[model samples]
Target chain A: MIIDGLINGIALGCIYALVALGFVLIYKATHVINFAQGEIMMFCSYICYAGSTTFHFNFILSFFFAVIAGFLLGALLERLFIRPLIGYPILPVVIATIGIAMVLQSVAALIWTFEPQKLDPFSGSPYQLWKVSISPVHLWTIIITFILIFLFSLFFRHSLVGIKLRAIAEDLIGSMASGIPVRRMYNFTWGLAGAIGAVAGILVAPVIFIHPHMGSIGLRALPAAVLGSFGSIPGAVVGGIVLGVSETIAGLYLPKEIKDVFPWLLLFLVLLIRPEGIFYTYEQKKV
Target chain B: MKKIKVLAIVGLCVACFLSFTSNTIADTGVNKKVILVGGSLDLTGPAAFMGQGVKRGINLYFNKVNAEGGIHGRKLKYIAEDDGYVVAKTVSNYKKLTLKSRVFCLLGSTGSVGPKALKPYLEEDKIPLVGPYGYTSAMFRPFHTYLFNIYATCEDQAKIFVDYLKTELKLENPVIGLLAEDNEIGQDTIRGAEAQVKKVGWQAPVVELYKRSAIDFSSQVLRLKAKNVDALFFPVISSHSAQILKECQKANFQPLLFATATATDLRFLKMAGDSAYFGKGLRSFATQINHRDNSSGAEEFRAAIAKYDPSNKDPNSFNLFGYGIAKILCEGLQQAGADLTREKLISALEKMDGYETGIFAPMTYGPNNRQGTDSVRILRADHNKKDFVIETGWLHPE
Candidate 1:
């Protein structure tokens, strides 16, 4: 039972990691934490659901179509809402993202009524691994997370556009001085983050079922990103895993009420000791 | 001088129109021929189904009554404002429904917390609000003069589940376990379970609390399996119910699963799909009759909804609840008689005894007892039909 709980927690954490990647990517490129990342995830999943159900597209085909739709959505949102506040402070941009969140939330509600409906492009059957049951959705979530992580790691290391996105993250003005298309990179990062959110949403829909407020899963992602030191990508995965594992352990050993609070308590204690987070990278200045 | 004379003539005509209509339009919503009622429903929130369904039920009953020439020559109009299931919005909706609509009474709203928030205001104004979705015990426990209840509360539903297990299942010592959500309804259900468990001389049951937003229930299922409980009672939303069903199947933890009225819908089965096969042995406690039961009352409800509320021909728990409450309100009006007043209506409601609402158990009320009924019918999950089948008649707990 304990082992089963541990496995389940890791699968749950992988979902958080996927969502945290969206937050981390957006913050990395534009230095603005999009409050609407969760809603973006929810809306994209709805698009995926609509494509498969309404347009009669195959399940996997609709997923890829939704990913592209999500990319374009992120790019469009950046061009329309976020781009205007480029020269402005972070607070205004964050506020603008919140406004977009509200708009997106209502749009989803208007499109799909408030009633929660099932989305099962993925089945709920689990495979038995050494007497431990693992649901297919959870397995897919973990597999997709690892693949995206490996791909993102390579992109950041070797890809030219990835390097430009990183340069923009480091300092927008300096990147532009070096003739890097900083604005274009910011828009590109938003689209990339949006695509990441779509994957997370698609994986999550089978488990939670899709609703307008399902984007609230992003609430946990915000903390995951914060616990991962806000700047480091790998930190997000580690932080999410720790949060998930501890919650399951608490549910198994401690009182049930303690399970929900256990992750936040751990995050609190960690912040108290290491304000810079577990995987902090301090930047050195050149004179 | 000519323009001034014309303006004076127009002003006098307006004043005379107001004076002529003033007698019929009083401060109270009741006029010579119309009785206005209002509701602050969660039309667009997580519980929107409840609000929307109940509204249909209310309208169905009212439409039938209106077609038959209304209660005591007064036409009934129910105006509902969408609160989106938010408490603050429910409060604001309460204000708009009360002040702007000038409703004679307030009818069905969703969620306990929203009604609880509006309780103080309803009390201050001494306004009567009737037949809210039975989620709170606070309404009738203290016997608030203004709030009239028709069906069993969440606590009653929980106790009924336990009582059914003891009496029908013949468990000499029922080892009931609970999977409670971390919300007010969850706590209320736990309290009722504890009461029933103690009554039957059972040991303190194992309790598991899950978060409201928790989509995954594998850990909870693993915990339930570890306990090896005789029965697992979980009162949660439809999706949560469906998710728990799927997870329990995956884990192969087949305890006698019990759910509250919230899970009494095809929505759960539709969401659970093939996974709902695990719930073949499931039992549920609900206040009203299932639409598929095809009882006389259910038939009448279906016919009425089809005739009146054509859009919602298919009835669910929410619509059933509305129909029950609307019938009760109409009775109160009839009992109040030709000289209708709020106080008289309250007196009439208090005097209600064994009043059958056609869809639910007979309700009895008193001056001190505001609760209408503490009874429910048991239903068994039928996977083949993909719906709940009525297994027993109404059972009332002490």
Candidate 2:
């Protein structure tokens, strides 16, 4: 029973982790909490649906194009909406993001006309392990999520572009004084965040049915981001797994009525104890 | 401000006079032109699919009736608005339809939560609300005279399935378990299933509830596995149904799965991959017209939608539901015979008994029986089941 719980926890955790990673990516770069990250991810999945189902593109090709589409959408949103409000009061920026989310949702509704779409980009079906079973979709989510995380780490650590983004994130004025193009980096951050959201959306779609409302799963992953220290990349991963597994196990063994509160309970406990997150350094901001 | 108010009053009077004149002209030709049925829909929310489908169903039926010279020289006019599936918006939209649009009756208003919110207003206004998309006894309790429930209650529907498994399919000593959402709708199913189990000479079945947005049900399935249930009833929506089915298949718990009408979607089948079609459930109503059917009514609905808005082709079940209820409203209006007022039309509907209109079952309504479509038929499907097969003839709940 314990082993089964762990396996289920890890598998479910990975998806939440993927969502958290997207959240962390944007927050680290922009200090802007994108309330619409999940919707952006959900929109990407719909784009994938349009690519393969409506446009009849090849699966891999559709996925590649979806990533590109996510990047472009993110970059454009940053340039047009997020850039002008760079130094504005936080409320308007937050509200602007919310408006952007609404516009995107309305556009999706107009295009799709509110019907659930089934997407299976993978070729094979679910394969069984001893006493436990796993789907190719879930397995793909784990593998792809890890690969993306690894690639993101390598890019940030080794690439010149990555250094520029880090410089901007750490000190926007200092990065500007150092001749780094801060405006371009902001657009890049949005694009990267969009890409991450898209991948998360594609992974989530096959597991559950795809619809405009499936964006709530991304919002649920917000706790995953918060519980893992909002700014820490690795923290997001660990936090998501813990929350996912705990919730699933609680849904079974715990009082069934309170199972929905699993994520919140775990989040509260984590916050009370290790306020910076399970993995992050607790740096007190000197006001 | 004074000048604006005077101008506004004059403008209002002029608009009213023009409308009155045109309506008089229409009256001179045919008298009662058409009874307009309108609805406030949650076309962009969690229940958007249902809202969209119900509306499509109503439009399809209305088009057919309008083509046949309508009922008593009156064509059925349907107007719909997106309520965002929110209660505030639904209530506001209801007011707009009644006060501004002046619709005759509400044809198949959608949503359990939205309708629940609008319940008091609907009753107070005495607007005949026909065939709301979703069913709960709470909808029927305190019995609003203006409203007629077109679908069977979840309890009645669940009983139909349980009775079939016991009497017809003859599954012996069936150890059943219920998997439902943790919401009121899910709770309603659990209640219905428990009632059915007790009534059917069986012990109460194992019941488990999950949140509406849960991504997994493996743990719940595993617990039922320990119980070795003979069959499991998953009274859930399409998305949850897909998740539960995939998890059940993974767990190798091959119990006969039973689901509610909400699980009846092509999307559910597609998401379940190869094992999509392996289940039996009850649907409140089926489209009397489909892509295959060549009914003239279906053609007319298609044409109307094509003429107005050609883009939305894949009409959801709610659309057909709307179509069916509109037909019933037209039936009531036609039966009212002339002197068309709300009271006359309602009285005409009240006197109805076992009235079949091709699409829906024979409905009987009096002061006592405001509920419509009490007749439900058991439907079965296997892995390769092309369409849901009607296992038993239509049976009315006692």
Which candidate has the highest TM-score of all?
1
Itemize residue pairs with steric clashes in candidate 1: none
| TM-score per model over all chains | 0.94, 0.89
Candidate 2 runs further than 4 Å off: A1-5, A123-125, A282-287, B1-31, B265-267, B278-316, B396-398
| A250 Cα displacement, candidate 1 (Å) | 1.7
lDDT of model 1, residue B352: 93
Which CAPRI category fits model 2? acceptable
The 10-residue segment with the lowest total lDDT in model 2 chain B: B283-292
Candidate 1 chain A lowest-lDDT run of ten: A117-126
On a 0 to 1 TM-score scale, where does candidate 1 land against the true structure?
Answer: 0.94
lDDT at A100 for candidate 2?
Answer: 85
* Candidate 2 lDDT, A93-153, residue by residue in tens: 8898888887877777778866667887763545778766666776787788889889988
Off by over 4 Å in 1: A284-287, B1-24, B313-315
For lDDT, the strongest prediction is 1
Interface RMSD of each: 1.6, 2.2
lDDT of 1 by residue, B121-206 (tens): 98988888888776658777676888887768768877877777778787766567788788777777888888988888877777
